[model samples]
Target: MGHYSLGVDIGGTFTDIVLLDVQSGDHFSHKELTTPDQPELGVLRGVRILLKRCAVQPQQVVRVVHATTLFTNALIERRGAVTGMITTEGFRDVLEIGRERRYDLYDNFLELIEPLVPRELRLEVAERTEPDGSISRPLDRDQLLAAGQKLKTLGVESIAVAFLHSYRNPEHETAAVQMLQAQLPGIAISSSAAVVAEIREYERFSTTVANAYVKPLADRYISSLEDSLRQEGITAPLFLMQSNGGLVHTKEAKRLPVQLLESGPAAGALVAAQFGRDVSETKILAFDMGGTTAKLSVIEDGEPLVAYTFEAARQKRFRTGSGLPIKISTIELIEIGAGGGSIAHVDHLGLLKVGPRSAGSQPGPACYQKGGEHPTVTDANLCLGYLNPDTFAGGTMKISEAAAKQALDTVAKTLDMDTASCVPGVTDVVNENMAAAARVHIAERGGDAREYSLLVTGGGGPLHGYSVAKKLRLRRMLCPPSAGVASALGLLIAPPKVTRVTTFSNRLSQIKIDALEHAYQELEASAVQTLKESGASSTALVTRRYADLRFVGQGFELVTELPAGPYGDSTPDRIRELFADEYKRVFAITPPVNDVEIVNVRIDVSGAADAKLGKQRDEAATESRVPVRRKAYCPDLAKTVDMPVHQRANLVAGATVAGPAIVEESVSTLIVGSHGSFELLENGIIAVELNTGDRA
Candidate 1:
């Protein structure tokens, strides 16, 4: 009669699974190379292996939460379902005529995300909704049926129905969906209003198309995985992590898979926030670097920032407006240079470049002996002796130093340098790439990197955290006890959260408070219902209100949380002040005018949370442990040094290990530099404090 919750995350390079004892706070984790051809197979295998190792019965699992990067990769790689679009007449070309703004004007052949539905498959239907939430011309069931029949004949797996101004009045979109579902029972249908009930028809259309694109894939994967788990004797209720860093029922995820685009990375950010608050560090930069990519998120006041709109499948990783606009609530993060498996190659200009591309799992880093001929960050670390070949991945993943050196030697010959020189270059270039991108993101938010501690997680984060922090001039870093599988742990720690949004435009001076209150109440009820459907108890539900506001003539809006409200006469003034404060916070200037307008209203409801992450340190029973000497390359000194190596398991609370040391765990390793010291905090966090003089 044990209470256990299982969490699993599938990444581009690896699949991570964790089993937590909700009663005793004990946990066991496992990692393996991802089976790209069938991502869920790897996760299923990893879970079985972990449960077997811990001698726990599969039936003991009472809850299961899963997150994966499969959806995001599918969208970026254009591997999603074949989808068709059924839109209002003359607006069928809206997907092609997006925004009409060039992301990069100078490039003649600039690549943009291709419309998910080809023009041939984008059929037109006769229907219209007025701008003011009224039906103008509607009830063209014949045209809608004709379009559905044509799409089915074209062999489309799903269809997106988006009519102009559907966000304001959804009746046309809803009626069209019902008609399509009745005629084409086999096809999945997505409505723009149901997916994104906000302003801007272009973004709504794009997001609806995206949901249709991923629906078939998610349905197949989730249903298959659930059946497989049940056959394996684990009859737990299954849940999924969404991009907004919240858990949702499997049904909800399948119905709206676009929301899961950043699920895996979102969990990492959540775990970082939890650890940030545990040690009293309210502001932190969460750095999660895995085999294929590194994701950076900012946590302020012990919570990760949440954004409603973000682009996907960008041609330029850091450039705004270079990708398909996706309107969904997401934990804001900037993804840049990849992790250990990121390839390193000399550019045509004779300069070395670390990755936006990676070797991934099929042929990971050269050290993995998996047929990869390219040198990668992991290969460089292995060649430099920072990674212990005998202890990597719990010694389950065998690595070859000779192979790593051979890969580095090839890159060195091109630069007319020795392998030793090229090894450090790879690590340095990758660190700089990550730091540079992170700096831009932090600065955009008006934050200084030096003012925040770097909370590092993932298989490769700890190995490079010190270098990245140094480059950013950060004074401190934190690598928690179970950093490698932090995402899976987060799935257990996260609560079920539901978000509802609507377009409600009105100038501040002329707005109706009673109408606004009515809108908020409706939104709250919808969100609360969704939470309940996700199996959350109603008693402890918490609701938060937000407003997307802007100056009267501004094109974009700033999101601000509304003060708790039974909103009344006084609420408008308070809201106006909040909008002004937020505007100033973002722009660092007084508002151009006191005239403000509310563009949208949003509500978020969070269910009861049972945080299961371990709070107590895994301390040694009685004795203190000593470190053994190991020779590893020192990047700062540009030479090899005999560094003190210690097993992370043996380190107790309050134990301090000084510079030029190695802290090794089965799944990950931490390399402390000569300029800093690693202190084991009472809360099981390893705080890396750099010497103040090192800034010189």
Candidate 2:
């Protein structure tokens, strides 16, 4: 009996499926337009296509990994189930109160984010837990039971349990849950301590609410998907991609779906990091422009940066604290509503705005001929001659160039310009928007965009990589094979992993090593259990640790990786040295007089698995000499030129292409600008560099 692995990624516009023969390393991919009415429709369709194309029996599939933006979309669109929250009596408004600090202090009109759980839905119970994990006050069992019944009567789909200081001690929360289960068995429940287990009250409360909001939907979807797979004879264990850049068993994922809010984007970051590992000493700015959004992440030293919390459904798209804060260990990335399906129009000032609104897959872009009259980036790409009408999606869907012209002409006529002018106008605006977002995001992270190599992946990424790179004065861009479904492919590269966080808050010198070690042991055990449940083999275990430490008086902390071994024998000197090294890298110097405190400790347990991406073949020994040509817009030269085109399959080892060329693959295109050239690296990467008017 042969075994196979399947990865399913559901996006805003399309659902992608990848089937791999675990033994032979053969793979097949399929893409289907998403059905917002029922996401499972697209997922099932894509899976059927992939399995059919590979002529593989579903029973042969040993494991299935799924990633979706459904939770994220539900939050952003405010389409989640009716949910209610239960918290400590005194903290009923914690989510609304927040820190009370305005992100922009001087701006009086700054909009505040609306709490996910409105006051009406936030029921209070007399229960309290101290920060030290001691029960300050016993939970009112009767009160919690009554509250559960009240919520059930009100037709609440789910309930969030977020008692004060629950991170330190979840006893009260657990008791409350027991009571809620006894009284309201139908309502789904999410506990904060189980989800985030961190110190912040507002973040914890909000995260719990977010979890409650999405639990019902996630549970239904996961259940439906599982049944569908089983019906197709796929008895494989199913896993889901979490925000922490790891895979979790489907059973655990349902219990804690909040960790998967940014699952799709995190998978993209994983793909970028895997690519980065092959290119030594390269800083990567990963660009993933799909149908509904363009996602960006900064990768340094082959690891994507991690963030503790992210806001979703932001009222103000680019600003923090303008949306529901979700607490999870997620690969930090920024998103802009600037993708192929992003709508374009002339604004009130007669200035063109590319988007924050998307046409999406239902009607899609006008070029998709799905009844969308709105001009979109895809329409613009079609009008600008970047997309092939018959070859789009491998000719699976017919693209109407005439429809694109009509849509672009609408914007053009409104602006007193032509479609040609309108197309570039929208394209330029989109590029500038992406570039500006890149600048702000990179600067905040204390990075210079010019110093990083841009790895563009996704359907729309290659189409706009050149222009965006030019805007940022970046000369290099690399597009991987199957870039359109890169996120799904990335699922194969990710390890089975878990990130557990605990708040310690003790001065390093005065810390009780025994208690700390015990905490670490517990966390590690939990992580190992999670991995085992996910079907990780014994040989795959790889446990790593980190701590969030800072000077006693500092408001923020820096994360430092900790050595994992026999915790009892480790010296303070070893710990201090690691802290100092990380500290100096950020602040240039460590204070000799300041007392350092370990605020939080994080444990990451990983189970390594074989990445299915085959090793790079030697190009010189394996490719053809065929080079086709196409007319493309060269922004540097500021004109449409007949550019040499080469099938990526034919570009072998040592193959070099000068500027003003296009490397077309089945999945994506790599545009070589007039100021840069590309060469096939021995490791299978198309290494891009500045031409500087000289060539080897």
Candidate 3:
């Protein structure tokens, strides 16, 4: 008897499910169209299909890990619950005022992001706390109750309480929350200190408000999903993927759903890092292109970069300050609206543009035959012969080539070109868009894209990775098996972790060692409690410490790992040396006179590490089946060519394929250009090497 783990990841267009046997290291996967009206319905359907396909019983499932983009979608679509905010008097407009910096300076029609909570719903109460954790003005209980009653009368479903200096002292906010919860019994309440206990007021309040806005929705969905699973005979413990690339208990997720804003993308990055480590490639560029968006992340030394702040629903995709900011630890990545279902059209200036809008699963690509008439990247790929209509999705789903052509023709007529000619332009535009976004993201982090190997995952990633890599002047790419569901698999491989952070600003030289020790001790206690709630034993817990340090006057801080210890006089000097080393590594120079300041401390406690999946076993070599040849458009040659198509499953280890070929897998396809070649590694990964001639 063996225990099994199920991983479910709900993306914008698809729900991916992976079921893995812990003892035998075997797995099964399935993908289904996401039900936007009820996302959990898709999850349940995928799970049922996958379990039946694998002939596994629901009782064998011991754990369930899930990641979803529902919260992110709700924020972008403004479909969340009616939410209100309560703050200290005179600070009710903090969310609207927001740093008072315009994202675009010269534009006369600049539109800043509107706060989630409107001005009328943002009530104020008389309460104040000093930065030093002292209560300057006692919380006005009567005023707080009146505000709560007003919100209740207005039919607000959720409330966020953010007072001035709440991060320093949560007493006032906590008191307000108690009163609100007592009066409005069914209403959801979120406090800034509990959601994101950081110093920045705008980010903290935004994060708390966002959490409250989504809490009722998440709570209902999770509860419904649990009940559905129970009815289906699954008694497993449920965990959720967090934006920080860790898994937390369902209880924790319901309390702070804002931390799951980028959960799906973070899982993809984790899987990319795992694959990079497996191949011994430390510098990796993780590129994941699914149906609705493309995500790119950089990994160094088998670790992805982590940031304490993230933005959502950006008005401008490439601009940093054009979105609502949330303060939560997350993997740093850049996401663009380049994906398989991205629509292509001619703009008002007659220039061709490929999406910031998508035809998601409901009416996906024209080839899907679900009544979509718009030309999309998938339609272009189909028209260009990059996709096989007969074998798409293992032939379970039919593709309409006529529909694809009709869709492409509409856009082609607008561009004044034949469909064949427009096919390459559409694909090239999307690939270039991704390449440009990757370049900007890497350059901003002081990295050179040419120095990294691209690890491609997701359905569209392997299809377009070669071209994207060529644009970036990269020569290597790796596509793992079952790439379409890699993110779901990542959930199975992730370790259960809990991270706790607190602001502890102090100059390094003048820091009180006793206070620092107490802070860490408290964080560790909290982390331990969280991990315990997630089912990790005390003996199996491993704690790591980090400190955010910067020059006294700097606006941003860099995190450095600190050694476990009871701090003494000598520990500060060691900490300084670590900071200097890190500074030199990042900036290539160490300042001489500026004193270092500690801004925040973080604690990460993780459970026992997950076992890695075993490599695919090799079978006895047999006579290779004759490759099928198809006439496909070659972007490099600017014409159609007779390209060979090989089934990925039939290609054994050490098998090689030349350029201008298509390697078709059950769920994805890899298109190798004329100047590129691919070799199947023993680990079931395709290593693609692109020559310089592959560039456009």
Point to the candidate with the largest lDDT: 1
lDDT of 1 by residue, 1-696 (tens): 859899998987888888888987777788889999988788888888888887889989999999998899889999999999988888988888899888998989988768988999999877778889787787589878988998999999999999999888889888888888888888999999889999987899999999999999999999999999999999988999999988999888988899999999999999999999999898899999998999999999999998899999998987788899999999999887578889989999999988878999988888888899898999988877788888787666889999989988888999999888788889999999899988999888887888889999999899999999988988999999778888888889999998889999998899999999999999999888888888899999989999999989889999999987798889989998988888788888965587889999998889876656764232233355777787898756778999888887777778677898888876778988998889888877899997645444
Q: What is the C-alpha lDDT of each candidate?
A: 0.88, 0.82, 0.87
TM-score per candidate: 0.98, 0.95, 0.97
Residue-level lDDT tens digits of model 2 in 1-696: 847788888887877776766665555566788898888888877787777766788878888888999999888778888999998897888888898878777888988877767788889989778878888788888888888888888889899999888888888888778778777877898888888888888888888889989999999999998998898888888889999899999888988999999999999999888877777736999999999999999999899999877888887788676787787889999999998899998889998999889999989999899899999998887776677676676445888989988988888899998667667888889999999999999999777888887888888888888888877777677777677777887887778988898888888778878877877888989989888887888576888888888877888788888888556545455777888899888778888645678888889988886556753221122255667676777767767888787766677678666787777655566777788778887756777776433221
Q: Which parts of model 3 have CA positions greater than 4 angstroms off?
A: 615-624, 693-696
lDDT, residue 354, candidate 2:
90
Better TM-score candidate (2, 3): 3
Off by over 4 Å in 1: 615-624, 692-696
Stretches > 4 Å off in candidate 2: 568-570, 615-625, 692-696
Worst 10-residue lDDT window for candidate 1 reads 615-624
- Candidate 2: give its CA RMSD in angstroms: 2.7
How many Å off is the CA of 271 in candidate 1? 0.6
**Candidate 2 TM-score, true structure as reference:** 0.95
Q: RMSD of candidate 1 to the true fold?
A: 1.7
